[model samples]
Target: MQVLRWDGGGPMLATRDSSTLTVLIGTFAVLWLLWAIKKQRKAAVHPLPPGPRGLPIVGYLPFVGTELHTKFHQLCGIYGPIYKVWLGNKLSIVISSPSLVKEVVRDQDAIFSNRDTNIVGRTITYGGADIALSLNCPNWKMLRKIFVREMLSPTNLDITLALRREEVRKTIRNVYDKKGTHIDLGDLAFITVMNAIMNMLWGGTLRGEEGAKFGAEFKHIFAELVMILGKPNVSDLFPALARFDLQGIRRKAKRISETIDRVLDYAIDKQIKSLAKAKEEGTTKTEQKDFLQVLLELSEQDDGAPSMIMTQIKALVFLS
Candidate 1:
């Protein structure tokens, strides 16, 4: 008889639960409405540049194919001379016209002087310690001043004249020796320039038989580095997934950086030993100063100017 009688409180309990659920649903809707209203108000206050709406997460990244320049040109036609493109979470404004380019680079240079560095660029430049990829700041300004006023000054260039001439003569001789064989002018030119740069940097050169072997290795590594840098990296587009490095660009960059770092370290060690030997022999005054020497001296200085670190020196030397 007790089981046959239904519990009337069961219905009441069910009704109470339904009512609680209703209240929660209404609260959620109210909160969502408030958020949407706030977002709309903010957008109204400062509207962004007109651009195509993208997908939820990937944005326009997928649509931009290998021919980025062509795709950008097409987008320019559709969106006007200047428009925004959402590459994942990052927003980039494309200024296709020359006038705007000049305005951004020349007229408002300081305002837009800072560069947006990617993962590969940061790695290659040793966390933007080099001038080319560094942010526009006091350290960058000091580095620029040193690079322009001291390192690449007419006096410094004149001092390195003999080094440059020696490399050029060696290159000419190498070309003459290889006249019978099929010549790659590009490789020759690259090696010549690299040798000249090394001479100016630390009074070294990648010439002769041993030097040719090293030069070839360097060329291959540099080409690989350049290819990786130019590739479309998912990590660059989606910063949240950067740690995952879906494309392995970061890993490649790190390996290349290590190889370059070793070469730089070897050169630096040799330079330091030479400098020390000169000082000990009382021939420091007679030793012709190279860019490395100048940078090393600057590193030792306690002048008001921002002091250069080993990383910066290496970055500058590598970049040069």
Candidate 2:
């Protein structure tokens, strides 16, 4: 623990030990006085929510446990729906009641629209430009519009309907052909779902044994990636030590990101070549192009706002 000293503006004591004790005592009293006055003034301005008292520096973390869900209910019963809890340097407010939740989410969405982005999230999202992690702004709105209006519009869905139908049909046929063979329904469903998302993201589809093999690889790799993302890293908690990457979380993240980039590069190259051929032939060859193509096209346009970059494109692709 780092010990911070304050030069208390109070009467000095005789001995060194006595002076130190006096300074500490004076500092605590002054801080407590200021906090009390501020809280009183704030209460006068607007009624504050109730919560348990916390110790200095550590906040409520030392008392929390793995069973946070249960603890949340107990705390709610005591402090009501809207209460605050400090986790390290962060202050978290929980809202359990539907009415208050609505006030925050629906009534005043703009005030609380953006979710907090952490250090690990920034690394995973390539500086946090991804649609999911980005702050609420025109850039985020643009990405959402491209995703919803361009990629998921009625025209685009109609074009890709056949591809989705094809994958589902294949899955059904495989199930029928296998009959009584021992199978993992969860994995089968996972692969089918992954294939559908992959198709939508990059206009690629893995099928039969190939689909199963790719899906298995992805399941293991992505599970590990997710675990690393969720793992507590000392580096993230202490930004001063962030460069060390002490837990190797950032290192693993870089490796995973490289793999994803390589895959996206290959897919992007194939799409470009196909698009070029179609342009030359003066015809359309396949269904609506994937989100990558849409993004690439948008990036080519030099608008007032900053053009989308490859990192952001990869972030979106990784999410899909």
Candidate 3:
């Protein structure tokens, strides 16, 4: 049997096949032209921050690697104090030197106050529910004010100082007990600070294995979120490629978010149930007049009136 070939051999290939090939080429050409036009339009609208040139699609993602701070610092040394870096479709301005940081953060705070909404931040902070991660808006402003007034105010601190003192004394006692043993000072200091913060936020101590587990999980989730946001994200650099979500960043963010939500929900539900019982019994006495109690009281007021809720309280707790 003779083998057929593209070359002029046997019967010539059909004219229809050549026409189909022509149509395919034309289609690809038109699509590419349209894409170029769209890209040009976007470029005209939002001029990208000035930075070192990068590869197409991936941008400077490969160059960033994992150590974001180190990579940014290195780039800053070469490109001066302020420079831009791309991760996939996203662009970020890196402020390295203290002078530049002061200029942007202190002087131009109004311009930079509104945070850039990133996929990672949105997921980890419960769709921007947390004050630290939320965008600058009316809700954020109100929450921030409440946080300052209710949690971090000078009067609140005065009330909480006794608790802080007790926690610190316990920490010192524990350190003294471990004097004979090989104690990790770093671990001890971390636990001390964490316990102080937790006690202030929850009006309780983080003791025993169960509390340890919660602390470990919370720390891991928080650290992961900070790491993800701090690093160069490809999705932010290239918005077009954001849908692809390479590196599974969005999935990881969602998983971390769910874990945080579970913890916060458990705490809030307990507080709400206790508050409901107290109201039903008509008891003016409270076992503990904690931040949660104050928030519940505020939430009971008219919706039109200024109020606070579990979400805002939880955000304040985290911020504290």
Candidate 4:
């Protein structure tokens, strides 16, 4: 018993161990306080939707299946027609049942008619100047009226139908010529539809290298836009994180916008020049009526003034 002497190193080692423990404890306390503060702030701003709790920061993003529509419908079955899910920090209200959809889309149309601004629509529609994607304000209403009255009216339907018939006939003729040869029906259909739309809008068909370039560009851009729109974005959920734009959505939108602007600018310039030439020669005729002529005439009138901007004209022309 007397041989059990005091070890001098014991106290020094104990002191070091205690110091490390203190540091770790302090760090943990600080982290916990910060987390509490964040939770308090979130709770103060917007009430969390009634739903299952999700993991920290990530929310229910990982639990969502590959097919969003299917997952949404499934969730609706469990949570009812109107259920909320978090992509990250943002909350998305899913409307699945037909009755709920009708109530929201039809009955409360005015309240819910505003367009959802996202990366893709902003890019593809020139910051949403196009009638289809633009905000549901007076400007949008004006454009919509113009589109309905001038471009897609019952009278104009005949123009579109005639062009469609001619295009289809030409496509059939081409297929007949290529009989027994391997051909893509989808591609032929796309070409026919695009040519018909273009002819109706501009009174001419896209052809040669320019046509090929425009077709490829439009298809590529449209595909990109569709893909983006079809997918729900994580950025939309977290407004604070939107500044980061983690998926490069904004960048892609800018690139698409620039490409579209270039093509549209050329088309507008050509149309303006044509209008000027026709005016100079007194050959501006309405017998060969088209969407452009109608829009120009409406632009000059103030009977139902809508403050139509040049950008609106460009957007309408591109869409037509």
The TM-scores of all predictions, comma-separated, are 0.82, 0.76, 0.70, 0.75
- Per-residue CA lDDT of model 2 for 1-320, tens digit only, reads 23345558755434567668999999999999999999999888865578777778657877777788888888999999989887666677888999998999899988898887666677777888788888889989988887788778897777777767777988999999999899899989987887776666654433356545644555566777889887767665556677888888888888876766666676666766876777799986555556677666667677776677788878887775
Estimate candidate 3's RMSD in Å: 8.7
The residue-level lDDT of candidate 1 at 235 comes to: 87
Best by lDDT: 1
Badly placed stretches (over 4 Å) of model 1 are: 1-45, 204-216, 285-288
231, model 1: CA deviation in Å?
A: 1.1
lDDT of 4 by residue, 1-320 (tens): 12233588552224556668999999999999999999999888976445656788888888987887788777777878777786787667777779989998999988888856776666666688889888778888889898988778987666556556766787889999999999998889887777666656644333446655665677677677667677666567676777788888777777877887887676556666777787899886454345665566667678857667778877887776
lDDT of 1 at 266: 72
Preferred candidate (lDDT higher): 3 or 4: 4
- For model 3, give the 10-residue run with minimal summed lDDT: 284-293
Top TM-score hit: 1
Error of 3 at 152 (Å): 0.4
lDDT (10s digit) by residue, model 1, range 1-320? 11233487553224556668999999999999999999999988966677877888988877887898999899888989889999998999888999999999999999998877899999988999999988888888989998998899998888788878988998999988888899988978988988777667766423356445655566678889889988888888888999999888999999999998987787677767776787798875324557887787678678676798899999998787
| Global lDDT scores for all candidate models | 0.82, 0.75, 0.71, 0.72
**Candidate 3 Cα misplacement greater than 4 A, ranges:** 1-50, 65-67, 97-99, 204-246, 280-288, 302-304
Error of 2 at 183 (Å): 3.0
| Cα error, candidate 4, residue 261 (Å) | 0.6
Candidate 3 per-residue lDDT over residues 246-291, each given as its tens digit: 8778888888767777886776677677777867998753433555
Report the Cα lDDT for candidate 1.
Answer: 0.82
